[model samples]
Target: MADVARLAGVSAQTVSRVSNGYAGVNEETRRAVLDAMKELDYRPNSAARALKRGEFRTIGVITFTLATTGNVRTLEAIATAAAREGYAVTLLPVALPTQDEVRGAFSRLEELAVDAVIVIMEVHLLDAVTLTLPPHVQVVVVDSDAGNHYTVVDTDQAGGTRAAVRHLLDLGHETVWHLGGPEDSFAAQRRADAWRAALAEAGRTAPPLVRGDWSAESGYRAGLQLAEAPGCGAVFVANDQMALGLLRALHERGLRVPEDVSVIGFDDIPEASSFLPPLTTVHQDFAEVGRLCVAAVLRKVRQEEPERGTTLVPTRLVLRASTAGPGRRDAE
Candidate 1:
């Protein structure tokens, strides 16, 4: 500190302010201080600072996998939001979706230098385990049914599913088939339930669901089965990746999308627009969901009354070239 202050031609207090990212220092002075610190190879002791402030200024994120688009995007959003608030994020990945894995992760929370934790896995696994954490550490959950016990933030899965189903029905499709996600996924189950309810409400019989593991490959396999089903003119796939695979399978079977079969998907991923004929899909506000998760956890950390119940980020349908009125070939 003394060496940096001397090199930067600033007082020790000014160096301290710059090192701690405290305001009041002009840009030029700050830059000079930074340059001096760089030259001296001086690193701020975050441990000492955390101890002095009685806060770690860090957050822990526990997630099962980053393979899914929603989890990846949500985690990105959380990191961005946390960075803006001058907080660092530490990710703890659980290799599998088991109670033992989840419990193992939570047990380590006591030793982590984080003030709070944001769990991004399904809540059922947590419920199955006798989990314990540091009493002072606050918690926020994403995509879970634990809103009654913790602050929860997630997309409106059911509402989005309903909108997709209704859109297909209004387009003159007599009934819409479904390609659902894995049964264990809460979001997938909510979507499946909404799809069934929407069909029943419209006086249309709901077809048996074909499940996928939220992968393009799984969707391809399911799509092959749907392509052979009689009167399967419209389909609602759970997510866009599976929709991509379904599109391929349909093409292989010479099924023309929106001509013989119309398809709609969820999670309007970046590649949806570039798919052959473009994909009509549901759009989720993943950034908002991530923002809310960070906000909820920070509020809890501050000893503020945590916002109870779930905060649902609404979803909307994006119409594109993938869906249309049933064609002449459909009547065959």
Candidate 2:
């Protein structure tokens, strides 16, 4: 520190301030210190600094799978948001949602230098045990009902599902059918429940739900059956990937989109608009969910009172070419 200070013609205090990223240092002096440090190959000890501050400025993200679109997108947003907050991310993937596997992941994170953890608990197995988790680390959860135990950030799944159903009904469809995600996924269950509830609220019969494993292949199989179901006019798919397969199945079965059956999907993925007829869908703000997760965990990281509740980011109904009234030629 003193050597760089001497070379830069600045006080050691000025060098320290520059190294710590403290503001109010004159630009010229900051440049001189940086130049001297570069020339001398001097690097500040991050571990020592973190120890002094009592925080490592890193967050650990634990998830069961990143194969689904929501998980992958949410993870991307978390990394971006963490970087904006001057923090790094460490991903810890658990092979299964079993209690032992989740606990093992947290145990591994405990040995790491992360200040907090964000678990994308898409599986219902984790939701059942969230309230009983050990308090060794501060955690913010995504896609779980852990509001009573930890901060949870999620999309407005019920609200979005209701909106999708209502939209189809308003367009003159007598009833809407659901192509839902796997039963074990928290999001899939929420959407399915909301779909049924929304139908009941409208005094319409809830059609039997076709199940998918959040995969395009499952959707293709489900779509084949739906093609044969009598009076299957409007279909609300859980995610866009599945919708893609469903669209293909409908096409191969010689059913014209909208004119024969209207389709609405969730997630509003980037490719939704490129589908042959596009796709009307619910748009989840995964980026906002990510930002909120980072903020909530950092509050605990800074020794603030931990928050225990769910925060929902709102969803929007995006109109595209896929959904329309029964027997209509296009979306309105």
In terms of lDDT, model 1 sits at: 0.89
lDDT of each: 0.89, 0.90
User: Where does candidate 1 stray beyond 4 Å?
Assistant: 1-43, 123-136, 328-332
> Which window of 10 residues has the lowest lDDT sum in candidate 2?
125-134
lDDT of each residue in 1-332, candidate 1, tens digit only: 99999999999999999998899999999999999999999999889989899899899999988889989999999999999898999999988766577667777765787888998875353454564333455888899767566678989999999999999989998888999999878788889999999999999999889999999999999999998988889999999999999999999999999898999999999999999979999999988988888888998888886767888999999999999998654564
Q: Would you list the clashing residue pairs of candidate 1?
A: none
> Top model by lDDT, which number?
2
Clashing pairs in 2: none
Error of 2 at 72 (Å): 0.7
Error of 1 at 317 (Å): 0.7
